[model samples]
Target: MKKIYLLFISCLAAFILNLILMNSAADMPVFFTSYLNDLLCMPIVLSICLFLIKSFSRKKSIRISLFSAFSLAALYSVYFEIYLPKVNTRYTADFTDVLLYFSGSLIFWLTHKFDSPKNIQKTT
Candidate 1:
């Protein structure tokens, strides 16, 4: 429940921040601002997906989920680097952007790995 709440809040903030960046005088999408958009959205989206995936099977501990989530994020970041630009002209492949994505993932992984329910027994 807490995870879901946090994901919603963060994703909403990211979207709002993206909107804010776009509507500013720059008059361009945030994504066009040198990975500013990726830096904002990657963690929210990836962490949510990773949380969802981890929730599917409760057999794994928080550490495993953390590693898996970050690993998946890294793999997907690499995937985007190799495939996204090819799929669309609006995007160009960039490893540095992927680095930002991985950083976000790692942060979330650590947060959840240490504090997730897997580490606690619900009293209720």
Candidate 2:
């Protein structure tokens, strides 16, 4: 729970910074302007989703499976990078974004930890 909160807050901070950079006129590196958001997308989104799931399920020991995380990254890549680019002028296809999405998932997977049953304390 602490780890998830930290991950969520850190990613949220990065996202806010990125949003500021996006809206500001200050010249920034391409990474900050473009790829940073892509790199952050999954962790931020997944953290929120996981938080909601945990809240509703009333479970403190739940964590996302690696396969589920990977599948979501793949789905986002296909939809945003492949499909959206073809249909929307605002979107552009970039294979690097696909890699970044998976990278973000991996980051989320590594950082999103919860106590196991053995470690959880039972209240009397």
Candidate 3:
């Protein structure tokens, strides 16, 4: 739980920094301005979602499965990259963004953990 909270806060802070950099006039690398947000998106969103689910279900052991992470990545890719681009001129499809989304999902899957009692053992 502490790890998840820390991960979420760190990711959120990165997001805020990215937003500030996006608006700043100082020259920045393409990765910072363009791809950092995409890379951070899923971990932040999924962490929040997981927090809500845990709160409502009151299950400390619950975690997001890999399949669910992949499904979410696919859904986000379809909507943000494929569908939105077709409908809105402001949005353009980027395959790299899709990949970054999946990468973020993987990060969430790997880092989101709950320190449940079941995970601990009595030692002599």
Candidate 4:
């Protein structure tokens, strides 16, 4: 239950933040626009969610988490690509957005290597 709640909250936070970025006109910091945003937040959120689930429950594969991360990110892109542009007129879909989404998911997977608490402990 806690895992579910955590995942829900984290993903919700990411989704809402993404939406705000999509809608806002204020100038974002350079890092936020310079392709590092994918590495910073979304991946961290997903990886932490994966880490939390592994910490809480049965040891399962990460395949499901990766798939879910990719799916959710892609779905978010597609939805906004279609709707936001139609509704807001200010939002436009760029191929770079798709690239960023994929990069975010990939980074999320890459961070999974460090997701295990067992690895965080000193073995010797």
Candidate 5:
């Protein structure tokens, strides 16, 4: 659980760095400026969601936590990839972004499950 909190903090730092690289005028590769931030979207949101779940819930449940992570990812994907483009001139829908969100959510879910002590059964 403490490690999960650390992971969330690290993800937050990466997200902030992505924001900086996306907005900075400094000369850099397009990958850093455009795709990097998009790639980080899922992990950022998923981590925050998972962190909140662990923080507030007295009895932590993996199923519930994973559900919340993916649900938030889905909502974010829809809002950013579908709704935002229609409402804002600056935002445009990209399928890659949607894929990234799903991919990130899946990765987070798998890693969390594997790393959790509760998931490991002792062979007596």
Candidate 6:
């Protein structure tokens, strides 16, 4: 579907931009380079997968997507911030990364409003 394609492209663009920022100027804030990517990765990837699978009620899709994103963020936070640090000294626990992950999910939920069924014009 067109919507799925669009979402995919958008996610791809974000990923590319993230990579660019990561390798670009060292002056870039940590939030803009690493934290921002962590925050955005879940929502974008999850949304792409959901949209590709099938269509559901708009509200239901939104709810499920948000839940999935949050779950992933939690898992990621616990792994990277808690578990990984215990095993690897290189991995430092950072609460700010967790916060950024949540922020990213929240942003996805907010921006997703534009993609709601009520907002999309159905082709006849």
For candidate 1, lDDT tens digit of each residue in 29-76?
Answer: 445556665665555775566456568857444343455655766777
Off by over 4 Å in 3: 113-124
- Whose lDDT is higher: candidate 1's or candidate 6's? 6
Best by TM-score: 3
Global local distance difference test of model 3: 0.82
Instruction: Supply the TM-score for candidate 1.
Output: 0.64
* Tens-digit per-residue lDDT, 16-120, candidate 4: 676578568477775555445443445655656655765875645433345677776777677766668888977876667767777777665544534453543
TM-score of 6: 0.65
State how far residue 119 of model 4 sits from its true place (Å): 9.3
Evaluated at residue 48, the lDDT of candidate 4 is 62
Reference-based lDDT, residue 89, model 6: 90
* lDDT string, candidate 6, 1-124, tens digits: 5444465567668878878877886787766765766766666765665565446444334333556667777888899889999999988898988997777666665555456666543210
Single out the weakest 10-residue window by summed lDDT for candidate 2: 115-124
Arranged by lDDT with the best first, the candidates are 3, 2, 5, 6, 1, 4
Model 3, residue 38: distance off in Å is: 0.5
Highest lDDT scorer: 3
Error of 5 at 117 (Å): 3.6
lDDT of the structure predicted as candidate 5: 0.68
Each model's Cα RMSD? 5.3, 4.5, 5.1, 8.1, 4.6, 5.8
- Clashing residue pairs in candidate 2 are none
What does candidate 5 score on TM?
A: 0.75
TM-score ranking, high to low: 3, 2, 5, 6, 1, 4
**lDDT of each residue in 27-70, candidate 5, tens digit only:** 87877776666666666666665557658867555333566667
Off by over 4 Å in 6: 1-8, 55-65, 119-124
Instruction: Write the residue-wise lDDT of candidate 3 on 1-124 in tens digits.
Output: 3776788899999999889877985788899988999999999988888878768875556778778877889999999999999999999999999999999998887775333435432111
